[model samples]
Target: MYNLVRFLQKHHFFILFVFLEVLALSMLSRSHHYQRASINHRTNNLAASIYHLQSHISDYFSLRYQNTILQKQNAELLHKLALAHLPEPQPDSILKERLVDYIPARVINNTVNLRNNYIIINKGYRDGVARDMGLISADGVAGIIIGVSEHYATAMSLLHQHSVLSIRFLKNDQIANLHWRGGNYRQAEVVDIPSHVIPQQGDSLVTSGHSFVFPEGIMVGTVDEVMESEKGNLNSARVRFSTDFGKLRYVYVVKNVYQNELDGLAKIKTNE
Candidate 1:
């Protein structure tokens, strides 16, 4: 207290000068039109800058909420799209209802730099997520569920060496198997496309609906390059995966309604 008093006494003259200067400015601003206008403009600018800073901070924190909302919206759109693309009812056949259902999930854990990459989602049997369920992102097919807990599930990512998905050429409907080479996260190899199929660069491919994991016509990727096998009977393609694994935040797990019936028949055939 004593030091503060002495310091103030020593600078009293300078302090008084500053105080009078501020008082004069205040009076001038109130009395003169131009000074008042300038002061108002400065005040308005300061308020606007503070508001902008507040808004920016709010948006930064709300990003996760916004992403979750987008994921749910995408799940709804995917459900509708799957139903719309169902094959037209045959002339004498009854159309099946509810062929597919989508469960929205957030990716809680993921890795791309592994020999067999896996994705862990915040959904499990409790959320109707199960093994063999297909996972997809907003852009394309993401993975297939391989393990499930009560409240979480693990999926085999498209980047996994053992991950294989049956895909078909969008142009010619030629079927092939997609497998990853385990180095580049963005590229996969398409095998079993016969040489006679003639795939070009940028040819689009989609799920074939053979395994019932994914709906037919879900995009896989585009052909980046093609090479003829040494045997000259088959062609392989380097597919640029549509789903960016590094940026995956949310995914949809697709459950096929008729999967049980299909699995029963397959088990019987295997036993026989």
Candidate 2:
């Protein structure tokens, strides 16, 4: 009690000044219409700012959950897409089973500036991801899984020198091979194009689906420049890749249901 009294006595004048200031403000606001309106407006604005900050904080915290949901939804949608299924033998025949299944994965490590770049994803053999499975980004084709462990997988990015994809021109169905050379990661080269097929700038390309690694019609890129072989027998073009390797964050691993059977048949043919 003695300490409390001494503390109060020491700060009594300051406390009284604060109390008087508050009292004066209350009286002025209550008596004058302009003061009351101004105070209310300021209070409302402060409250609004607090609420806005709270909302943004909530959204930032929930972003990862939202992204996971979106990835699952996209995988489901990809499974249902007709391009992921084998074509029906008859025009009116019932649709065949889906040829491709997509498993959502997050890229944990990536590179874009190397001659032989590789990508490491969070999914692995435990998640049904395996060697030779195709990898694709939201925008387009990304790479192919080359190695897998129980909990992680590594892929050769499409930007690698050894990475090659069988691609087709969307406009004319011209098949070509896409490969990346050192330098710009945004671009690759398409070769083995037949001379008869003339490629123009901005012409779109997609997966050929012959290897069964990726589904047909998945976007690859667009022609940025047309080039002719020195021998003039084959044409080539520079392609502006659809998937920006530097920005790769999430990708889908493609699983072909008939891959084993197809491999068996291919092996038999090779023996013959």
Candidate 3:
């Protein structure tokens, strides 16, 4: 108590001055309209500044909530972007939705070192995913959806020798077939393009979306080397996929709303 009293006494001169000034100002403010307005304005501004500071501090600490909101916003925006790029989904068109109808999945099981390996996703029919769906990573096409359950799905990795994906050149727009040669997981083959098209090195290859599997224009790979066949009119090239199949972690499985109809038609034609 003595220490407190002594400290107050030491600053008492300034404290008294401030107290007297406030008292005079209060009286003057009540007597003069302009002074009252000035006092109120200053008080309001001080309060506003304090409130603004508090709000900013609170926002800075609520990063978890803010991050969740941002993630949701990003997902919604990407969905819309996907819709804008999809095909028109003509009634007779084989491409199902040709738009934003895919579920993002994390790769839980994968294989790239072997000739016959598959991948498992965390999504399934319960998530509106189905079999034969197209699977793609952000960097490029990964594989095709093969089977699905209520809570999970399986993708036929492009590393599978039995897998065949049709691709096309981004430069001359020539169509080709992509298959694994079982040599390198990072590389695949684009085969059977017309020799006349003359594909050059570094040409980009992407999904043709001709079948009911994937959307058109999905990135597949790039032509790293073009080999002219001395025996036939067919040209073969090595493609470096936008995605590293061996290092795949996450993927998106595309669902065509009209996949059944498209596949049925194809089956009917085959029967015919």
What TM-score does structure 1 among the candidates reach?
0.68
Candidate 2 lDDT trough over 10 residues, lowest sum: 34-43
* Candidate 1 global CA lDDT score: 0.80
**Candidate 1 wrong stretches, greater than 4 Å:** 1-93
Could you tell me which 10 consecutive residues in candidate 3 have the lowest summed lDDT? 34-43
For residues 86-185, write the lDDT of model 3, one tens digit per residue: 7665555443325547678766667787877677766777898766678887677888766665666667788876688888777777777998889788
- Model 2: pairs clashing at backbone N, Cα or C within 3 Å: none
lDDT of 2 by residue, 1-272 (tens): 99999999999999999999999999756634422332332112333344445544555654685587568757878888856477656764334456779899877667898777877777778999888889998879999887776677777788776577999999998888998887999999988888778799999999999878898999999999999777879998999998878767768999998899999999999999
lDDT of 2 at 232: 72
C-alpha lDDT of candidate 2 relative to the true structure: 0.79
Candidates by TM-score, descending order: 1, 2, 3
lDDT for 89 in candidate 2 is 60
Q: Looking at candidate 1, what is the lDDT of residue 116?
A: 70
**Residue-level lDDT for 166 in candidate 1:** 94
